[model samples]
Target: MNELYKVDTQDPVGEVWLLSDFQNMRTELCEGERCIYPNDLTKTLFHKDLPRFPLLVKYICANDWLSVQVHPDDELAKSLEGDPWGKNECWYFLQKGRIAAGITRQEKPLEDLRNGDLRILTPERGDLACLQAGTVHSLGPGSKVIEIQQASDMTYRIYDWGRGRELHLDKARVATKAAASAIVIEEMRKFDWKYFSIELTKKVEGSGIVITLSEVPELHVLIDDREEFSEEALLVRPGSFWSELL
Candidate 1:
């Protein structure tokens, strides 16, 4: 059975963490915190049954901007880096504002990222974006939402907006290459179903992809099929399940 786990908040950014123990999501709250996977149950289940958990869900908050980052795929992570986990994530904006996301340069060669001339894109509220494994991306100031994908925490930071702090340049460069190697941005298409599905609109600027979807309670269930059941939803408030629904 699927279960909802509350996310613990962490520092640097404010966010609530929700994870299933089966997924072993460590960072309960706060943004930029790493979610650990291969939870005890997933580990045991994999050993016993071989195939069990398929995906991981995360709640992210970005009061301030996050480090520019990317993630590796499973094969690259395992064979090249020897890391067991790699990231593949998609974002659904729950609450939005003047937020930033996606890579800055569209036509520039990946090598330019090394020269550090890449630009950044700032998206408005109600935007949706997909970050396939290894896509260089970051969350801008004042953004919060849910991220769903494979369970992994391997990230590569490419840039930090001259905040004047010590940065992980070495790892960021390595991760940038990994992300650049597997970059893929398909135009966002709208859902055709009229009775239930929400419409999606997308555009591409520079090298980044931007998307906008309708913001309404009716659209919530369209993001995830499991959201329909009150028991399966993540209650952000003490009685949010009953109150929000009512």
Candidate 2:
């Protein structure tokens, strides 16, 4: 792990929050003698009515299969959880691995998927998988990935591989969408989604304006692309930012 996120662990660490504003577990930033958390920083960088930071970025190291889970969309999130954002996430793989994404067919029952039958996708290093809300998915073993998503942490787990962890099958059934699935992208340098944009590059040639809901936006950059990726992040006012080689 990078010293920025280093931790003492007896068991394998599943995930690291690189930039998150989730309560209690939020990441912090320091400027000279001042230190602030992302949630508090949002109040100054965004509208006063803004509930929280709009993005969550993480580094996940999956030693075992993750829960077969689904997330609610913005509409469902508002009605079900009374939250402002829904999770629409993407994974940039740093290690070759497999993942289960959506149902194999429209007729495949969600119950059958709970028993471990799923459509598997093998993604190579440098591949990106964009997963919109309601996509039933699971990360397979040995996947080292960078995940960027909407700020919400609402996950409805469908299955847990007999780990005996609580399964949110009822909520997951409501959240699962037959049409939702992972869109695996390869050789793509840039991604512009509804909430944010991401670029994977060794070089950035020019200046760019980051268009987002917030007038001022924060950019999370993953530096030194290796096993344990490092981070270089900055907050830009009026949503403008510069680009250069990492």
RMSD of 1: 12.8
Question: What would the per-residue lDDT of candidate 1 be over residues 13-94, giving only the tens digit for each residue?
Answer: 3543344334344423222574333333333323232232333555666766676666776557676577554566655565
Residue 33 of model 1: what lDDT?
75
Model 1 weakest 10-residue run by lDDT? 237-246
For 67-146, candidate 2 gives per-residue lDDT tens digits of: 89999987788888988657888887776977888786667667567424567888997788999999999999988777
The whole-model C-alpha lDDT of candidate 1 against the native structure comes to: 0.42
- TM-scores, all candidates, are 0.50, 0.77
Candidate 2 matches the true fold with a TM-score of 0.77
Q: Give the backbone clash total of model 2.
A: 0
